[model samples]
Target: RARPGLRVDAMVLSGGGGEREQEEHAALTAFCPGAELRLTVLKLADGRLPAQWEEAKAAVEDLRARTEPDLVLAPRTDDAHQDHRGLAKLMTTAFRDHLVLGYEIAKWDGDLGRPAAYQPLPAHIAEEKVRLLQEHYPSQRHRPWYDREAFLGLARIRGIECHARYAEAFAVTKLTLDLGD
Candidate 1:
């Protein structure tokens, strides 16, 4: 809604096949209506991405072949999850010319850190995001950290950091600023 002509494309490198993949696809659709989503289930064992490094890198290379994204949103390099960390490490290697923003996934591992960038979210948008998460991903509802409060609380903290009511944070390992010379 913010950017009228913006084209959004999401690529999921690690996924379980069948029903779980379908559920994730549906959730992504609900979260970003009209966005293009591609799921490549490498079928790597959970928390073992480091062991399946070749396959992970291959999947990312394939995505790079298909899309030349201007900006890429990927898991933070320092994320606790092995799958997330593996994918994050590959993002810059594959999308060398694009700006890749490493996003955080709040989870039980407590890997949240001081992010270098922030995207301010209005109250309405923040609330809607939490509602969508609750409504679309039923499987995750059981997790203690999957409730509205957890989401909103993190948003609130990030908001304070960025001087906004609510916000999303990202870790940027490198950035090039273009101030017209």
Candidate 2:
């Protein structure tokens, strides 16, 4: 039986802002330690992605041309933050042929769009993930919920969907299934 998820060949992160990408990078490493994780960085002016969508689109396309990943995970199209929303839309346009997964960063306004592909992290992995986030991203530590609880909490809630102990949510911007008859 084949698993549904794509074998992530290379991951292209939009930027290092908001600790979201950093967390994703961390999770990707822990979750898929054996796979190669490639990065494409676009450091746009913070909080100014909507107007600069083209720059992101171009950068990511160039990345796709180079890495040729089976799957491309980006931000959610509908999100509390404009950057997240903008990047999601741009990635959707760019990676039409690849499986694009959207990641969730908990916000006060709620996860604007429902996620499709959820990675259920084990309890210990979730805790260790929080620790890695705190240790590496020192700049975000003072910020609220950038700590252990929020990350672990989100995972716990997602775990409820399948009675798992902990988990992380991701949205699949595009996916295809082959149901054999």
Which candidate comes out best when scored by TM-score? Answer: 1
TM-score of 1: 0.91
Residue range 39-66, candidate 2, lDDT tens digits? 4445677688767777777876776577
Give the alpha carbon lDDT tens digit for every residue of 1-181 in model 1: 5554456666665456866577777877777675556655556666787888998888788888988788999999889888898889899788877888999898997889899999999999999999998987888888888999999999999999999999999999789889997
TM-score per candidate: 0.91, 0.77
**Judged by lDDT, which candidate is best?**
1
Q: Which parts of model 1 have CA positions greater than 4 angstroms off?
A: 36-41
| Clashing pairs in model 2, backbone N/Cα/C closer than 3 A | 102-171
Q: List the residue pairs that clash in candidate 1.
A: none
Q: What is the C-alpha RMSD of each candidate to the true structure, in Å?
A: 1.7, 4.6
lDDT of each: 0.83, 0.68
